[model samples]
Target: MRITRMLGAAALLFGLTVTPAVADASPSPSASGDDSAPTSAGTSFRTATEVDQGQRATASASTGDYLYWSFPADAGQRPTVRATVKLPATHAAQTWQVDVYDGLRRRQSCQYGAQTRTAEQGSATVELACVLRTVRAWSEPWANDPLPGTYYIRLTALNLTTADLGQPVNASVRVGSKDIGGSAAVDGSLAKPLVPGIAVSSQSDSEDGDTSKAAVLSSIEPDGGWTSGWWSDRWVWTGIGAVLAALAGIGGYALTRGSGRPSRVPPGA
Candidate 1:
């Protein structure tokens, strides 16, 4: 009889412990993925392959126009470039080529193929095209340790005779970094010595703690499919919830201080 009684007590204790554990383990519906979906379309910029052309050049016959591509230009310094050149409606040409250089310092070339019609407007028309002669033009991958300086791009128009066209050279190239899809190297000035506006907060429970900021700015999703957010593995909210629950349990204990204690004076004595 006593053993049965003990078994019932043990079963009751086990039930109490197991109930909360099971409840905690049950999955709950939640808004989990991509909490910060961009409300508007993202800004279009050049990728490593796409270069940027900022402004048009004044008319010139002596030499072709030059375009400038800036590094560290945007928040993330994406390494791609784009440029547009509008040819005079009267001008006719059969072949064209583009030359990309390291701003009169190191000469590099990328042949973006031939000019194709992109758009047409009143008195003026735009052709979407690139200057690539051979399969591998001279465009090079952006350097992580790029020296702070100016780079140049030269566009040339070829006539039907496969030679220089008398028409003036006027075009633009938009310059930017390619979509590395990985972390760019950090420089000392922009890298170290944490500043409020600069550093991205690290995962709370990360081994490095809050002290670790991302080495480089994150322009896109992380490389390994990892993500950052409130519900992400090391979120502070889970710790916050546990803290609040502990406080509540403490308060409940304090409230029950006298519930089980016998009074000094006998009841109904």
Candidate 2:
């Protein structure tokens, strides 16, 4: 009876001690709101590999033309979108704009800025950056907050010189994200995979059977597979730790009971 009582006490003690430790060790979800981190990277639109966010690809565009790229983002992650446009010395000064949109095709307002004429020799470089805020889509119907999913970036050449018409201007873009303190509890798997946006001019190429032209404008690939909430991966490790702790407690209890037993005496004595 004493051994049984000791075993019961051991189990209870473990449950009281390890359970709270596990809970404390787990990360707590952040409150829903605009929890964006300070962004250092300037924004610009550039062609990049589907899997890589560092490598960039260059594209040439004429006046009044647009370039589009899509990137995946999760709630609580502050994603920064940037693009850089280089104008040749031969061309006159021009103005460009970068707009960000949500998965639902709704234009999301973001802080945008640009720096031009930073280079010498009459060449101009434009840099733009937008830092997104955390969004809770289900609760806030009136607010146009940024949510987790695929986001589209449209780069338009607002003002181009007449001499630069038909001349291709080089541009590059990249998207980066960092985890701010929060959790995307409301977000889940998307019903349909998000598709990358295509340039307006490239739309007619498909109908005209011009595969090459369409391919050029459709170079941006879809953002890879969906990512679960921040706590998803942590839960897995917590479960494994709990199981191991329970096994250790049981082994300790068994050894304690064995040690409490009286030693046997020899018959010859």
Candidate 3:
């Protein structure tokens, strides 16, 4: 009876310790393990890769330069993501590494042990490599999925040869934000008068006693389109027209007064 009691207590203690550990390790299914792919902004993205070669290290020393790939210009629904990194012709037979990062500069995924081979023998000749364009290192994220923002993708060639080769390339993509892509030219309206976001107005008295009007417009967001302001469209038109008409009258008087008339007559004998 004593031996039986001791064995039972040991078994119960073991079960209690192991069960908690298993519970901690296994996350809730609904929380992170649905195996569903992440959503994105579906913006078109393109960025170059960096290439290099080294003498000491088998792979070349290359750093991918991050470039702005694309983004959403307006707010909209989230999209699914599809990204890729391409190796150029100058790449030699060696292992390479590709890394993906989030907006916070945190490394999300790293994939190494990639090999490349080409059937070429000349410097100018193109070397061909075959691999999956889009690599998925994880089926699901550890915590929440990536939110709408800019993300970076980096690729480095490993085990490179001792020769000057292609440059390293890095690219970025805007994941969810609506303002992540190229912009177009905005057409001006009468009310707006194409006044830029930051406009500096200056009035200076010239040597000839005429006031010169000059303004510099700084860059603005939603630049190439109509923008909202304090005044209504009708009120803005009325204000702009009144100011421009007054300036035009002043300019006209200056031109007429300055025309065919010398500020000072030549000294007479």
Candidate 4:
């Protein structure tokens, strides 16, 4: 009876300990959208017009054409952008690029990863991935800061070897936001202009100078990556290890209990 009671107590403890970890491990609901078909020059990031975060937009472009989209972001939020291009048979083997820009119109440096393949009948598909760092201000006063605001993504086709210069390729763009666990100094607004113009009113000379500097800083390089959110976090793997240990303990305890049972002898003996 004592052993049975001990086993019951252990089972209860296991339930209490593992339940919360499982809940914590569950994934948060992500914001996502898709654009099946996009129009030519469908949106402009220059005008601060962009698809909402967690949403996707599609468009068709040819050589020398640009497709743009914007999404809102906050400090400590890691934003990821992906672009996929589907080229027709005639547009195969062309070079393409995707660039990321911050609210100040500064060209942000990003880690880029791409894959290309020749499809059936000379068609090709290209996939591009760009991941932005947790938004934050620059440490130096003269350096360009990645503040909380609308970020833009530009997709362009570089060179076309095909004779059909007008041949259009379908492209899709997607943006995702993940919380890296920090607060920003300020929040961002979609209505705010990408580059604030110099103040004409009699404001402080310092304030006016700051605005002018930001406009010129738009050309600064960006910092970004190509990894997904799940792979970027360390705590997730720790939780997984804890759960596995608890399960192993329970299985071992059950086997020992079964082995301890007494065997029955035949009545004829």
By lDDT, who's the top model here?
4
Write one digit per residue (lDDT tens) for candidate 3, span 1-269: 44355446555655654454344333112222222222221221233221110000012223232232222111111222222333444645544344444433454432222223332332322222222112111113454333222334343444556652445432222122112111111222123212221122322332333434433232222223332222222343345456556655665666576557687889992
Off-target runs (Cα >4 Å) in candidate 3 are 1-91, 110-144, 164-269
TM-score of each: 0.30, 0.50, 0.24, 0.53
lDDT of 1 by residue, 148-173 (tens): 22333444443333233444445544
Q: How many steric clashes between backbone atoms does each model show?
A: 33, 12, 23, 9
Ranking by lDDT: 4, 2, 1, 3
lDDT of 2 by residue, 1-269 (tens): 65477557656755765564455333223322322321122233334223223334346666567676666665445666677877766766666677777766678776444522233336667776776665332335575767655666777665555776776667776666555432434544433223344443346565786655543322333234344343433454456567667766876777677666569877886
Local error of candidate 3 at residue 167 (angstroms)? 6.7
- True-vs-predicted CA distance for residue 232, candidate 4, Å: 18
**Residue-level lDDT tens digits of model 4 in 1-269:** 54466556666766775565455334234445344322344346654335555555777666556778766665446677888888876544667788888766788776445522223335577788787766653224365656555677888766555574677678878777665541332333222223333232113345654444444212322224211122322344455556667666776677677756468866886
Question: Model 2: how far is 249 from its true place, Å?
Answer: 23
lDDT of 2 at 146: 72
**Candidate 4 or 2, higher lDDT:** 4
CA shift at 145, candidate 3, in angstroms? 3.5
TM-score, ranked from best to worst: 4, 2, 1, 3
TM-score of 4: 0.53
Give the better candidate number (1 or 2) by TM-score. 2
Error of 4 at 205 (Å): 20
